[model samples]
Target: MKTKELLFGACLCMFTACNMPEKGMDVDVYEALDYCDAQVQRTLTELKAAEGTIDYSMMPRNIMDSLNTWHCRKATKDEWCSGFWPGVLWYDYEYTGKATIKEEAEKFTEPLKFLSQIPAYDHDLGFLIFCSYGNGYRLTHNPEYKQVILDTADSLATLFRPRVGTILSWPRNIEMFGGHNTIMDNMINLEMLFWAAKNGGNPYLADIAVSHADKTMKYQFRPDYTSYHVAVYDTLTGDFIKGVTHQGYADNTMWARGQAWAIYGYTVVYRETLDPRYLDFVQKVTDVYLERLPEDYVPYWDFDDPNIPNVPRDASAASVTASALLELSTYLPGKKGEEYKNAAIKMLASLSSDKYQCGKSKPAFLLHSTGHLPNNSEIDAAIIYADYYYIEALVRLKNLIENKAVI
Candidate 1:
């Protein structure tokens, strides 16, 4: 509840900053309306400048370039993260109708298309193929991209382990399912399954996703609305054993990123199933989330861990929540939806104006992102995924308010 108090105060301050004249109306909504439009323009400008060239998008020009070059050269399949950018670029292409973005994005996507051909796929497949090609097919009605999505879905469907009754979170032979079976991260994976089902007319794939969701809800969620970073369940009987904190302080302690993933994940689930339970879950988690947030609208990496005392906050979590709130807002029916929309808008406004980093040389993207505390990795730094999701959320909010597009 103290966190809620902080969130309300943060919202109140944002409201005042936007100079709203009315009571019971969100000043953040109007301000966000303006901000979303401006952000798209700015992002498009950058994308245009990139011009779909590998050398430009490569290192020496962008940190993403450096990161990708490192991944391409050094990291193995397991360590090669950040494969989500191509999909993000595709997302931008869909939203903006920019041919240049599409071209630049394919430079990233074409290789993944080959990877999808492999019978054995990995977790990043959903992030790469579904987010990019699947989205492209959905928007453009392109048959080739649609086939790519199906191929990827088929591979993912095969990855489902009957032992856990969930898709294998990692390709490792080790049996650890904690955090890998995380309900939060799997929601995005479910989106791919849903698309696969709709496109390929394979109801089984959709059913597999839904079943996994059902299992996750049963085992992972706690009574207090706080989520575990990882929960290992008996695949056979669906029993809970113990939770291992994959990225947070320890088991059962809330990781800010995981929490954000859950917030957005549950919101995505609600959109898919329209289960009242999902909505209730969202409200409960959002309530707990809003209650615990710091005044700046960013969250410390770990909610329960107080050892650091004065650690840098994960602004990436804020960006994720801002995006999730925007999606969750659209599902609202009438006045209540308006309130959620306003809250989301306000959160984004605070993020864009106060937290967002702007400059050419400033590598990664967005700003104030915290990756992990234990290893002292990219602590409180800009992250590309943060920028991608932030842009995704902002664009979604614009589409929602302007066209009233649901889902």
Candidate 2:
């Protein structure tokens, strides 16, 4: 009898050990905030030094790596990534209340005012204008910022084709994407439209956002909820052409960031519209995302990439997912909510570690983000949007801990 009891006890111990959470899974919010603060200060110092050396003739594009050296580039106002830098500064100021950060935010934002007047720009107006001016209006309630946001929303709404029932993402002039290409990334831009309608813009702007989301819902996803990176449509006939994974491994494969965008986008849509369909959609997508995540809670650039364990991970996707999951937790009930919250916590813990978070030596905060891996572009590098969403996630977590309202 004694021998049998000993064996049973040993088996129970093994089961308990197997169920333990990974290291860094239980992150302290205070510590995470401290880490973010230090990183932001380091990034500020790096930017100050860069201002003297890097030419900002056009606008700050991204931190580029050449022969292991990182530098910024000047890009056109229509560049998709133009707003991320200013948006980062605004976020830092929001979190730390640092006047220096606020001053820099205003300085960077000044150049982007012209974007609001250019209606011919593509679907990136939200990433270009809203991330900067939308956050500005949220914090300061500045009337000028509000006007720019309203104008940009109107400009973005112009891209919506009633026949296609979706906003055109890439212009027809871009030969690669054809005339009417819509991408999963465009879902992130809808927040600006939702905000515009809620504030002062036309209600039809919100309708446009809903229509685009509904169309994406109908056409962009596969049977298992993994999404295609791009969907092509005939502009004149409003006919479905084909769905392709332009940045992914193949047409049927899942791009990590594209899936992240779908999950985050639907969560925001549900937040704004309170439509049960959006919530259900978010749950389905989130389930697939959580199940496919690596042991570290980070995901490879492409889920279908044959490389599997050897591929580059996209920390940006993880950051975006973590932020979305935090909001999603609030909307869900009981075990489901706790499960998502825990998953987000695990992702944050992994992202905050030395492997993913950049040190003071680097200009950017988050590292190992894979952007366009198939194109051999920006692979395993620091991306500004990654840092933006990381900080945003941390702030949201902190707010949740403090029982404050989270946006």
Candidate 3:
């Protein structure tokens, strides 16, 4: 570590003085796409070099050291973030139609096949399999990948306790959490189950997803729609226990990324079911988050943090919500649709500005992403999930502009 820490203010001052695109300006779809594709290529090439020194079978996680290189992780159950690096390659391949990127995506994705073969180790099977294989199968209908996704969905379904009405997120930490526990992040894993049920997997899979989402909507949120990071239940009786947080500033505060996942996941739930119930509910959740954000629309790590400007911002949360709102916009009509679209564009504008984008110093796309600030881990760094969603949002924005379909 350096003697003088690189705080958010100092970083902002440097990027501001360089004057890379004004923050309030609208994003040009092609221009932003070009920038993101280049960043993805840089990430791929740089990670290829680092693979020999780091673990070859691992995936990029975050950049922490002054060297600005990726801190990668193996594709183990605990390493829930391992799937995103391959997912980024797949997105680049979809944009460029380049065989080189597809080849690398396959190489990275093939190792994660073990996720389907194993028992339910954790709830991240969706993040592990869906983000990589789901995108891969969408771009290229590889039958092998389709089977892997179905199998993984079945594996994920094992953790569901019917009485609790949600999937247990961290089976390994059940005792630590005091019972059957579901986090806000578990809402995201529902997509794989929904997808599998529609495809060749079990029909009950969709039922499980709907149950999980309904339970989360009922118990995971307060009256104001702000959410808890973790909601625990009795392991034996399956009764409602208490709402808590594993990653937020506290049990009562809104963790920015937890709220982001709720927005994104419910948007998916609404899409799959076409349920007006979810559609109406998701906007309430999203509106509360938007109303609380800072001027640029990028959120601080925790909205309730006592230290405001001095605290780190979560570019990843902004990225996730940007992608979600773009899809949410399509379902609505009139002014509401346009408003959602414009909000997402403004977020993209701020992220595209040098205020957040890491031009050359970092191997990843953007900077100032806080991952587990309370643990003092990966604060204000280029976490790989941020890069993944940023690219996904850019592609979605471009698709909406071109009158094409969004993936």
Q: In terms of TM-score, which candidate is strongest?
A: 3
Which of the two, 1 or 2, has more TM-score? 2
RMSD per candidate (Å) reads: 8.2, 8.0, 9.1
By lDDT, the better pick of 1 and 3 is: 3
Clashes of each: 4, 0, 0
Task: State the lDDT of candidate 1 residue by residue for 138-216, as single tens digits.
Answer: 6767788888888878877886776666776665623656323543565567777877787764779878877777767
lDDT for model 1: 0.64
Q: Give lDDT tens digits, candidate 3, residues 1-407.
A: 46356676577556533322335547865677777778777766776654443233789899863657777788887789988988988988888888988988898898899989989988999998999999999989999999999999999999998988899999889899898999998888999999999999999999999999998999899999999999999988878799998888889999999999999999999999999999999999999999989999899998888888788899999999999998898898767877787788888999998899888888788888889887888898889889889889988977765557765
Model 3 clashing residue pairs (backbone): none
Task: Rank by lDDT, highest first.
Answer: 3, 2, 1
Off by over 4 Å in 3: 1-25, 49-56
TM values, all candidates: 0.79, 0.89, 0.92
lDDT for model 3, please. 0.87
